[model samples]
Target: MKEVFLSTRDFPVDEKFGLVSQILRSAYSVPSNIAEGSGRSTNKEFARFLDIALGSAFELETQLILASDIGYLSENKLQEIQTLLQEIQKMIYSFKMNL
Candidate 1:
């Protein structure tokens, strides 16, 4: 996988302490929690991590919407990030349901 966090580097510097940072933090949390949970041995514990990841995905979606509304991000950019967030949300949801 590419460095997902690195991909957010292009967000406008004006958003350095705003939507840009929030989106980055939220998106990274999803995968970060997944990896950390995977390190645990129990399925239940892993499910908990997946749940947190789902929340992060939702948070990212919200941040993206806000960024678009604030003109901090273009419609294309919002859609792209939203697509990725949706995919991650689906994956996390599936994992949680299965567990």
Candidate 2:
């Protein structure tokens, strides 16, 4: 997610409050939700948080695709983020299942 944030540094200033913001918020949400969820007293609560994180991941994925399509991101960079997103999704799913 830090990488994603950094990657957006070169984005046009016009997008500073648009696509870039969305990407950053979505990237940050995953961990923020996980952290918030961990403080919950119940697995059910944590699972719900994971669901929110997963949703953010999916949203981020869509934004990334848009970034790539609009030429803001390179195919290689996009693939890297996509692969990481997949890994994150799998890990979150596994954690939810374990709960």
Candidate 3:
């Protein structure tokens, strides 16, 4: 998430309310959902939040691709973040399944 914010710092100022905003919101959503879920009363409830986090992860993935397509991110940086996001997605999925 910090990496994302750092990377986006170089984005066009005009995008502050556009791609940048969407990217930041979705990026924040992933862990925010997980943390929110952790406080739930039941595994079922937590799993649901995990599902939402997974969706946000996927959304973040797409937004990152779009950012790359627009040349806001370099291929190397995109790959680095994508790999990390995928791992997080898998971890979330596995944890949700176990629940």
Q: What is each predicted model's overall lDDT from 0 to 1?
A: 0.77, 0.94, 0.94
Q: Model 2 over residues 6-90: C-alpha lDDT tens digits?
A: 8899788999999999999999999999999999999999999999999999999999999999999999999998999989999
Sort all candidates by TM-score, best to worst: 2, 3, 1
List ranges where model 3 is wrong by over 4 Å.
Answer: none
TM-score of each: 0.83, 0.97, 0.97
Error of 2 at 67 (Å): 0.5
lDDT-superior candidate, 1 or 3 = 3
Model 2 misplacement above 4 A: none
Clashes of each: 0, 0, 0
Residue-wise lDDT of candidate 3 within 1-99, one digit each (tens)?
Answer: 677889999899999999999999999999999999999999999999999999999999999999999999998999999999899999999999998
Q: Which digits, one per residue and each the tens of the lDDT, describe model 1 over residues 1-99?
A: 133355457667777887667777887798899999999999999999998988988887787687668776678866776777687789889888988
